[model samples]
Target: MFDNFKKNSERYRDYEVIAKFIRLAIPARWRPIGYLEHLVRSRTGGRIPKGPFAGMRYIHTAFGSAYVPKLLGIYERELNPFIEQACALNCPLIVDVGAAEGYYAIGMALRNPDARVIAFEMEQKGRAALKEMAELNNVTSRVEIRARCKRPDLAQILATSDRALILCDAEGDEETLLDPETIPMLAHTHLLVEVHEFVSAGIAERVMKRFAATHKIRRIWQEDRHRSDLPFATLGTTLLPRFYLDWSVSEWRPERMSWLWMEPRTVNAPAA
Candidate 1:
């Protein structure tokens, strides 16, 4: 019964994804109703209310983007607790790979006033917004925004720091980039890598084995947090397309992501 219900819920969400695309394909002015909701929600900025990122400001002009759910604190329940923990620990350096719009990077910076954030974003639009967000939060001085990141980039950055945290969401590229054998600097950094089983087969297992020798590894799966339950959500907007749009694509949304959190086994041990 539960399996059937879960399947139905996914089907409904997929349907909504399709409907959102169709609705957005029509020019914004023509939408008969809820156009105001679309405009207002897609506006340029917001402040995170809770968790490690509370009070952090982010620019939101990219349209039809799904991060609205994240801003509402309804996305990624699995990571929230760890985020808060990271905040309290306040590692001296944070390496945010794929730092889209500086969410994790800037948030951690705010939580740790003494920590410096090294954010890497390859996409032009996302990089622009991330820089803007860092500046708006008055954290640009501490945020080193880079256009790209590779294993060499990470090594260079880690060489200068004592202890660091790596927050990675590099899609499937992690399989190639995160090999500890190739990048020995990883042994010094804690990690929160978003595994992409959908994009690469057997990735979760391979990645785990790679780190098992040096770190205590924990796997966290995505949790379903219904958007309607968010503190800011209202009953009337429950199924509205205005709130569903993300990144100019109302059709595309990420599938369930499995995360791997790795902590070094000892202060002196190399990252496996």
Candidate 2:
């Protein structure tokens, strides 16, 4: 009873109230406006102008414009190091859990031609966008799109490859799915998992403890540098809603999201 009361109390906190209000204010049909902006930016052509994955093509979804900095490859400072290490190892396969719209999956495929990417997303819109992006990037041949993935499925997939990398953003599901004892193959695979402590408290510590024996776990928090420089202020006078206008001004990130990057102790580091 007390736990329930505490949870309910947390829900009405100041930040929570603001967040709820923002969600209510945002129009259900945000796609049209986002697509119109995409047209203006000509971002659908999907060329990343700079960064390690430059020259890669990714079809921006209607809502993709909200994360313009991430699409342009400057959102997360911690992401690049793992990407670089993964590329250097040249793992044969990459398993992307919760691969929303094929951003990291397609981008990683573009970065390493020899590696195959298996992207898993359950939502219809996300699947459609991922397919289009993969096709646009000419990576359809190398990228496989899956509607959903389970831990056993992941174990099976990883068992087939000698060396593989797992990039997981499975909301709060990582707690259950990433347990090394249950999924023994995880001990051998390189992993970058988004720890959702915000959704399920103590999950980060639990996940860390699970992999401590065989893997070197590094926790990286979200990067705060959003693309504030975008001309949203000038465009605000136009038709865009106040929700988007306010959201655009800040770097898009959760209050607390940390990534657990795990490298197998047995796996030799690639030569510099």
Candidate 3:
């Protein structure tokens, strides 16, 4: 019974009803989350403080996840090393699907100046913020912002480059977008896909099956944040109470989340 209630509560939050309520009920930058954001911004000067994308300027808000962890550079700390390594490769094409406010898109752009970054965001506000960040970072020439990423659009983009790095967090749409058979170029690309099991049941299993033949798949689980994960945790805990610090780093995910990092194993990956 407790599990059921917890699951329902998670669902309510994921559907944005709870998150929306929290934002509306509480006015901006005063207490709780808003105050937490203020604290982080003052410390980092509105830039990511200590991660792969350190010194990278961010917008006033993050579209998803709490902005505090993002400023601390530990939002998805699990993927930090992998993302850094991928950026170091400086692949000619870097595609960010379901890019919200250009976190990965703009960060990767700053990391790999030579690469062309294409960001696919459906929401108008997100798209606008992405553009603003790109300009702020002065990578507008290398960054291409686009609306909803359909399979054909992805296929066409991937076809242009022999090697590409694709970071897809399209909610549950990743199942349909990352198929190697339909999008042949995907077989040649390195894909970091967030498999949304909560949003799409059995989607994680299905995503692996689609790419197993062409790539080496590594499953990465997103674990809960610890106090140690935050660079400021050691310094700030003494100043602020524990509860306030906890609210700053919490991502508040709805369910068990995992990502499939699929890298092509062969010079010519079969599009079968």
Candidate 4:
């Protein structure tokens, strides 16, 4: 009976009533369920599906595109372990660039309530949604949401930090953020940045070389191989396109870096 319930729950349409009940019972605290609902709705456009969170309406917008529950699930799963390890290391500051809806930022903050998280979202709608989600998760106190992704002022803020974790997903502007000068501002920071194929033409190699000269680089998450010629598809079909590269300052060359790759979690997998 319980197995049947579990199976049925994973079926999107079959869980509509239950999702509605959860939404009504805990409006703000239902992000996981709400995210599932959003994912199901977006994947099928309100049609029935064979996955969880079946009947909820998925908002259609740029920001909404990043809210796919399956993708978020993958991110959370892949990120949590690294975050736990980082938290254990006594890292205090975390900067999240391209923090759509605050998922990563909120999750990091929730994980380490004492840590200060500065989250950056370039889109107004995304920033607003991030604020709402942060409030929903009751992590507003720990997260600082900003409307800009790149700012000299922000770089200055980071310059004062010696121990920090920086996550950058600034779409195509990643090269701009990897400036050697900026590296000093983030000297003591560990970085997790998403490298876009197009924007990173030769930039990825350049950044890597420069970072190697000054830090220890570890690849924490890599997306499946992506082809630029592929057509855009639905969230379910398109998948998250960026790769998460982890970096730390080198011990031998405290000024040089080394890097490795971490694979991304499979999308649309069973919840843990």
Which candidate would rank higher by lDDT, 2 or 4? 2
Predicted candidate 2 versus true structure: per-residue lDDT over 38-116, tens digit per residue? 5324642556666677776655443232455555555455688877887888988899999878778888998889988
27-139 in candidate 4: lDDT tens per residue?
63333434334544454663222222222222332263323332324322334455556655445678888888765676667667677889988878888878876776677
lDDT of 1 by residue, 38-154 (tens): 443454246656555767775654322455554544446578877876666567889999887877888788888899899988888888888898888999899998987888888
3 or 4: which has the higher lDDT? 3
Off by over 4 Å in 2: 1-36, 43-45, 62-65, 226-246, 249-251, 268-272
In candidate 4, position 51 carries an lDDT of: 24
What TM-score against the true fold does each predicted structure earn? Answer: 0.81, 0.77, 0.86, 0.57
- The parts of candidate 3 lying over 4 Å away from their true place are 1-26, 227-241, 268-272
Rate residue 23 of model 1 by lDDT: 83
Taken over the whole model, the C-alpha lDDT of each candidate is 0.70, 0.71, 0.80, 0.51
Candidate 2 residue-pair clash tally: 0
* Candidate 2 lDDT (Cα, 0 to 1): 0.71
Which one wins by lDDT: 1 or 2?
A: 2
Clashing pairs in 1: 64-245, 64-246, 64-247, 65-245, 65-246, 65-247, 66-246, 187-271
Stretches off by above 4 angstroms in model 1 are: 1-17, 20-45, 62-65, 232-254, 268-272
lDDT winner: 3
